[model samples]
Target: MDKQTMLSDEELVKNFIAGNVTCIDVLIDRHKAKVFSYIMMCVKQQELAEDIFQEAFIRVIKTLKKGRYSDSGKFSSWVMRIAHNLIIDHYRKQKNQVMVSNDNYEFDLFNSARFSDKSVEEKLVHDQILSEVGMLVKMLPDNQREVVEMRHYKGLSFKEIAEETNVSINTALGRMRYALMNLRRMMEERNLSLTLS
Candidate 1:
């Protein structure tokens, strides 16, 4: 087995709990880059991926501080679970991303795979469609706009958003629902069916 596999996770946790915060640093150093890489795959933005990476660790520390997690299996799983949820939340919010100009559209701007697969004509047409949808999203109400921006751009959850905005999670969820409904109506009006995912 490798070095990490050789050390029992309990041993590491015990070290971390016994006032060796640097032991947790070792864990962070090992996992942070990989976790960010995974986030980038889903969120498709370097800055947003970095933000989510930091948030994931902050949540991890909170869980540890709460003394809620015992098994290392649960710890690792929990981290990935948080990352997964953040990515999903990001898509939901970005569904109606805004467009300030053609250059500000969100389509395949970050898709590395598309560059290799798409021709210039295809890319240009794709950018046009993205710009149109982004314009539609920009026309949504202010509260819905902010919620979507936080969800998509900042990768914050409904609960995290509620905490940030000093509102209830239900309010956050309601805003998201209305935002999606409005975006759908806008798309239908233009005969465009954009897939949020």
Candidate 2:
């Protein structure tokens, strides 16, 4: 488990399957940062991101123990798949309400060099678009909102989300349907059209 000893992903997987708990720790050390950052970027909430990070690794460990993964070099990809699923579950549980946690986040989705050179009027227009989108999300019904957030923010596949949320994949799809519809209605109410052409 020494940091100086770099192990290949396949080696780590083999050691982990052989009951070397230290291998799991080493794997976490190697991938935790990237996975955490990736989830954070998607979720935009620190507490939820942390929970999903822990859940992702826990699932990975369980899967390794189960000996279910069928290939190599795909360890990172598999872990990402777990992370995505957990995020969906997290939001599904929080659909109707907000979660209280100590983690805080500051994300600037609109701050970029592309915006830096824009005129003040253009910046205002960009800000308005972001504001409208935020408002639309806030107005979605509890269940629909959850589905949309999980799919868009967490990057979960419908099947993975269905597993995590304990719903049929069709149900997950229905919730997403309602979510988009409600968001569109809300936008239209505010004289903003968000239709995709």
Candidate 3:
């Protein structure tokens, strides 16, 4: 349990891939509220949302365990996309005339901005993963890490990053690319899961 406590989101995912079902619980416990709220926005019924939430995660598990997981985008985004699609499938199957404006649901469902009260345990676990990810960021090369911090933490654009770093826009972009590459590689080496905030 101590060892598991140190694992990152990608690491937990690796555990899930390695056949530890409990890892899935870690994932659900982390994202359940955000995902559930996203579902409720669509279905507007707690029971239906819960059902789709389970179905979405089941599909996530199958995709990961079956060696079909691909890195098309952020992991949280991918899972939310899966859940969104299932919601669509559900409504289609029932032939229900659902008319909900999707403007609110266009972004990642697990967006940290959508906040609710959290339990003490969830808060601690979130802080732990966030802290570890912070350490990983510090582990990056000077050039790459600088860009990552500027972009993610400062919410700067490529131009802004370049301006702040006194580099050309292309250089800024390149640094970001390399930073992401190295970050992904580092997480893979440590078997870290990219935790959602």
Candidate 4:
């Protein structure tokens, strides 16, 4: 057991900031499994996950080198958050590319109807409602948007959202609550009707 391996995360971060570069190697080695697993789980593609994982660590290294790292003593959580954000960014970029390449870019919540047995009219109504909701979700504040997307789209429970986001369960719930409120207000302001009437 090397001494650096046994050091606390904060201690390792401090040492790294003080010019002991090997401490960062130790830190990365210690947390890589958890961080990489998280990225892989979100992305579900080995190549994409690997890229985001590397980018997350690169951002960490840059932040640390710039003396911008605040010692919160939760380095693992910080790294996980970075990886999560990177995964979100990757999806957003992919979506933008799709929209750009497709001349008739319609938002299809259900990409395929393989499992659904709905008539064309019903499907169109459902798709329109989902598209409106998606636009409203995008307009929400980042934290609120994250909570809503995780809970509804990703089907994660509040506890899971809290764990993944490094926030308290109550905080996650609060974000969801506020997100709903904001979405309702936005819908009313826009006179958006999500009904099939």
Candidate 5:
């Protein structure tokens, strides 16, 4: 077995930053599939996914070369985040070209299945529900709304949310709990059915 193949991602990153160019290749080879798959899953387009995947690595290389990467032993997670952000930026740009009639902007919060896999009727229903839910989320209190957006829309973990919001994990979880309850209450009051008959 190659020694480089056995090195941890963090170790590979350190080696890469310390002038070992091949270490970056090993890191990319190890994580390319997972990172590319995530981008494909989110964007659902081959060309776009490839572009985002490349851009992610470019950003990763730039960050590492600039000594901006912290040694958190989470190099893969950090890479995935960069890819995710690129995907979000792509969608955000696309969204600006099209307008939806609603108080709140649309968000592709659900990551269950590929949108392209759905039938036309199913896709329409799914989009309607997503828009409705997005509006409901907009109506939540500021803190709860922030939590919901970060947790659901951004696909952030509770720990990440806590850190980003400068709160404890327990507090982040509590906000998510209350946000769900409030969304449920609002849905019930509006007699909204998320299901398609």
Candidate 6:
């Protein structure tokens, strides 16, 4: 292996911090496939995964440029964290998301997956609703948020979510249920309506 290739991720990060911008490129080139695979695993859509992959790198670049890149974790893990959040955020921003009523939201499992025939006006309104939903999801309690993100955004089965969370399947289901309930309450309390048509 070349000397640059032999450098560890932290070392590359340090080199980039020391003004060797190309080291960041090496870091990205080395980790792109694994990051893309993880994003694809979460989103189940190649195009969305690719967009998240690019966004993750853009975030990395911005952080490094601001000299805020921390060396405490594996660079791959750091990048994956960014990619994972972006996937979940994208999930919340998709069309036909959950809609809040008086104290709860109505859901259509199929709507979350299919694109609606939205016009410019409706699409803009829908985008605004998605942004609101994404914000509310970010406000959820940690465990509840994790479960909801994995089950809905990551597209994990309840069993898979349980295994990943190191919990029983029932616990995972309960967390997801509570998360949705919490999101519903949040939207109503904030007076955000999903029927923006």
Best by TM-score: 4
lDDT score, candidate 1: 0.74
Q: Write the per-residue lDDT of candidate 4 for residues 20-116, one digit (tens) a residue.
A: 9999999999998789878867877778878998999999999999999887659999999889998889899897886423345687555566535
| C-alpha RMSD in Å of predicted model 5 compared with the true structure | 14.2
Q: What's model 4's lDDT at 66?
A: 98
Those runs of model 2 whose alpha carbons end farther than 4 Å from true positions after fitting are 95-197
lDDT of 5: 0.88
Per-candidate Cα lDDT values, in order, are 0.74, 0.78, 0.81, 0.88, 0.88, 0.83
Who is ahead in lDDT, 2 or 4? 4
Candidate 5, TM-score vs. the true structure? Answer: 0.52
lDDT of 6 by residue, 1-197 (tens): 36788899999888888898789878988998689778887777767777888999999999988999878878898888998888878878874475534444466444542455667888899889878888898999999999877766666689988999899999998998899899889988998887763
For model 5, what is the error of residue 73's alpha carbon versus the real structure, in angstroms, after optimal superposition? 4.3
Q: Write the per-residue lDDT of candidate 3 for residues 63-155, one digit (tens) a residue.
A: 998989875566788889999999889979786664344476767455454454577877888888888789989999999999998776644
Residues 1-197, model 5: lDDT tens digits: 28989998888888999999899999999999789878876876778888999999999999999999988758899999999999889989998985545446465544346533688999899999999999999999999999998776556679999999999999999999999999999999999998877
Candidates sorted on TM-score, descending: 4, 5, 6, 2, 3, 1
Put down candidate 2 lDDT per residue, 1-197, tens digits, no spaces: 56424887778888879887788887788888679878898788778788889888877888889998667557788888889888788788787575334345365544566545667776777777777787788777777777777787666678988887889999999999888777777766768854322
Per-candidate Cα RMSD to the true structure, in Å, reads 15.9, 16.9, 19.6, 12.3, 14.2, 13.3
- Runs off by more than 4 Å, candidate 6: 95-197
TM-score (C-alpha) between model 4 and the true structure: 0.52
Clashes of 4: 0
* Model 2's TM-score against the true structure: 0.47
